[model samples]
Target: MSSKRVVFDFDIAFTNGGGIQGQDFRLDIDGDTITDKELADYIVNDMQLLMVRKVDIINKHYITEAHKRKPVNLKADEKLVDLSHTIFDGLVTYKGLPAPIICDYLSREQSKVNYEEGTEFQIGKITMVTNTGTYIDCPFHRFEHGKDLSEVALEQFADLDAVTINAKDAIEIGKEYFVGKELRNKAVLVFTNWAKHWNTELYFENHPYLTGEAAQYLKECQVKLVGIDSHNIDDTRGKSRPVHTTLLGAEILITEHLCNLDKLPENGYKFNAVPPKFKGAGTFPVRAYASLG
Candidate 1:
């Protein structure tokens, strides 16, 4: 492959009031030479500088050092597996909650008079509660003053190294299942295969759930998030919700009603279940999925 070389001077400023001024440098890069902004980012990352805010290129076309590094091949064998149930109109997810109302706010036939010939539009509207489908629960779901959906960071919900625990036929999952696994900063998904009953009457009754002891163990291990392919993370028949209380109190996000866990390996995938940034809302549906790499 051919290489492109660039010589430039830069001034970099850090976040902590520290700055580097007028540093001349040269770089040999693969493919075409990068833009000034790209060059600045390369410099900051290559130098391993911290808290950098700005990098200004000062001089152009001055040779200094000949450094050669192969360009990274970003292409990888990756696959995305959908782990969410499709939310349909008049389809019930939970027993008591109302089904989503899907209707067209602006019908295509109605828009014919307002538009030119053969031009029409349809605007759709959906009305449903936050807990309608595959949904995420933030700390505010259990606590009145805890972090809401908007307050949770993106890293807590997206691109996390993940592991799946096969707990099929197990109703009360405990900490023993997670004993030997690394749990820190990982999305720990419990697969019970209860999602097979989705859209059926059996999905809401006697479903698999995590024990409070398991939730405490995950909290102690600092797991970033937890998910389950079941009806609810906690046993809904009981009045007390210990699992939700323990997990959410620790600010560990929870995703319920996740499917397709069989598609993911134990540890080779990344998990993402991001919800909308709605203030004052604790729970909302997410398009949960996994990336196998």
Candidate 2:
């Protein structure tokens, strides 16, 4: 489906307060035509304004321009690409960390007793450390006084504008790799092609990592999150972890052990990586994905 947009003027009245109005405001729409009620609902949901009592649309027109956001359906051009490593029993992410243990809490045969005849269901249970697979490290992972997973707002992990940096053959990625790039308020993912050696012994040796200068540069740029398709984001040969220290100290989130990064373009898409809400936990696994159209 081709991208379509609506241009119109709107007068909105609040449920208990003043009113708001707009002229020539543009918005993405699903189809070529839309009812005024549906358009009002779209504006309310997208803008996230207060309660609206009623809306009046005027001078409405449709255009065939590119979508700034989204209002597409399954038959449209929007696509969702997975950018995480699948975790199963005995799968190692880090060198020293243990693998996840997956089992069934209630088997189908055992669940049959809880329900009527010919009806059954199964419940699964998993036991593993928070950082077992492709995981995110919040500020609390390094600083005890920083925000935990639950304290981090949901907006930080939803519909975030993102870009990818291709560093396929480099070992020590420096600030030069990230210089002159749009790095502010976006999830900058570094594609290292190191995922080719995933699940192999070579994956744990001499993996790609960001240098101290690069970490400091990203921090200075005020990037929202940093991700790498490698085993570790910091050099593991020594005792010090300067990359994690610098970035996490500034409250910049980190995501390591990412996979399928090559499927994403350098820009023009959104990134979402959300973990289960956990209190007092710093790092946890996430099913990260990229959205594009």
TM-scores of the candidates in the order shown: 0.73, 0.74
Top of the candidates by TM-score:
2
User: Residue 267 in model 1: shift from native, Å?
Assistant: 0.4
Query: What is the C-alpha lDDT profile of model 2 across 126-153, one tens digit per residue?
Result: 9998887889999899999999999999
Q: lDDT per model, in order?
A: 0.88, 0.90
